[model samples]
Target: MPSSNKNLSVSVIIPVHNGGESFRRCLSSIAAAVPPPHEVIVVADGDTDGSWCVAQEYYTTVLRIPVCSGPAQARNLGARTATGDILFFVDADVTIYPDTIRQVAIAFSCEPEVAAMIGSYDDAPGAKNFLSQYKNLLHHYVHQTACEEASTFWGACGAIRREVFFAVGGFDNRYRRPTIEDIELGYRLKQAGYTIKLCKSLQVKHLKHWGVISLLRADFFYRALPWTELILRDRQPLNDLNLQLLSRLSVISIFALLGAAIASLWWTALLGGVVVFSGVLLVLNAPVYSFFVRQRGWWFALRVIPWHWLYYFYCGLAYAIGTSRHYWRQKKQLAFGN
Candidate 1:
């Protein structure tokens, strides 16, 4: 339980823009949660969707950024205006569960060395579709387990001491694009020798609205751009198993196309190989899919599988393109002054 003292306060910063039903749900959940924030700061970024008015109904501390400054900027602005010792930055679409704030407070109290703590999101229960399942699996692989050498924390439901946040100069506004701001900020914090802990008790319910086209666009912007940035900064070759799969896929695709133009027998052999490779990818992802199906049932799984494969293909392609572009741009910039 949080102490009744007003001095030990927490400010929840929610950045919003055109968030429809999700925004309302997000706010309600926060309000419902135990140990409510001392103040809920909602940064409305040029929202023409009446999201600001909706927020006004619930929160008194609202800042409307004149233009659409993106989430990182909005979050920074909120942080600057927050009066709390701890800043809880959450997305407008997430619905945090009860006891989340209490858990975060307890974690910090227990571990004085921990600079920050991140919570888990409730992956949609009936989200059996391929893309949804893959996304959930990917998230689980990266975060569900604790890290002894903790580096990055998810931005969705993360808390940081005001002093630590200022020390790192907040998030880099240069990453104004869709989804990498969190990862980039986390990277910077790690570089500055701050410990980020993943707390299982602090949970948020994430409502993913993923379709085929949405998944593709997400791959291009979210997954691809950040990955490319990481590769550029780290200067490490893509040695992950996912990258290896993409390489194998690309090779098979090349041979299959070449054989089609040359001989019928070779074409048949290449086609068979491609089918086998596709089957292997599906099989590799089956355990995760099965888990989703068991949780959500078969109907959701059928819809999610194809979407997942499409996401995988596009994500791989986007990463390849983004990384190439980053390298080319860097080389060009170095060669030319402007």
Candidate 2:
């Protein structure tokens, strides 16, 4: 029987690897949340830091993998053991609000047709560093502004009905790393005609600190490349958060901006192309900059511009590379049948 709004049970599943202090705070929040979850399942994905032992302090169900499997496998393990109507997936480095679980329950109960829903990070991140703040805040702004009818799912603070989750085959275990596993699962759910919503009000606080090198590495290899390949593989619609129309325009403009700057050395007239494309970029992304300004004033927004542009540049490069690689593999398979 479909659970009623008042009686919906939530099982909070957290996957951690070397959780450290953030894990403590994550568990602490879960322990303190009013109307506590029906159960808390912590999956330690090969934690040598004794995060699994620490999880025992909270009196929640803890599962441990001998070696580090990716979060997708860890989450799948936790989901298999969860006994609640709603399987709430929270990252180890993120802390949820006191009413997060309650809100998930009410949302599902009220809308029986909602198979899954994902939430955004709060505007105020736990880390105060520039990159950390910019990255996390960018995430918050994007989710806050995105369509309510979501195209992809987020693992940071996402929930799915237990039955619906398994019906779509859960997180693809083939994703052995921390990449776009959640997004892939969301795509599959939608393909199966399941409804996934972006629940903006159900927010969580992100606690991970981001360094520039780490940010670049994660964005290019772990994120952009894999996601681009996934989109081409599934022929996805570019209607999701980062794949929106404005972002595509921005990517094209950045490449054009680069082309003009490079071509200007031989022909001075092409220098005008650089200025033109720059203006196009600024106009295209004015809303984002304005949102950043509203969130953290002019100085912070100014700092975010270059970093944001660099992000688009790399995304464009990744798309080109991934597209080439995907087709090459397709051609190889057709010929070699491997």
lDDT of 1 by residue, 64-179 (tens): 98778788899999999998878999988778878877776666666778888787666552255566555655555335544533566567888998889999999777756557
| Candidate closest to the true structure, highest lDDT | 2
Off by over 4 Å in 1: 1-8, 125-142, 145-150, 236-266
| Candidate 1: residue pairs that collide | 128-300, 128-301, 129-304, 129-305, 130-304, 130-305, 130-308, 131-308
Cα RMSD of predicted structure 2: 1.2
Backbone clash count, each prediction separately: 8, 0
Candidate 2, residues 1-338, lDDT tens digits: the string is: 27554588999999999999999999999998989999999999999999999999999999999999899999999999999989999999999888888899999999888899999999999999999999999999899999999988889899999999998899998998889999999999899998999999999999999998999999999999999999999998567799999999999999999999999999999999999999999999999999999999999999999999999999999999999999999999999974
User: How much does each candidate deviate from the true structure in C-alpha RMSD?
Assistant: 4.6, 1.2
Q: Find the number of clashing residue pairs for candidate 2.
A: 0
lDDT of 1: 0.71
- Compared with the true structure, all predictions reach lDDT values of 0.71, 0.94
lDDT of 2 at 225: 99
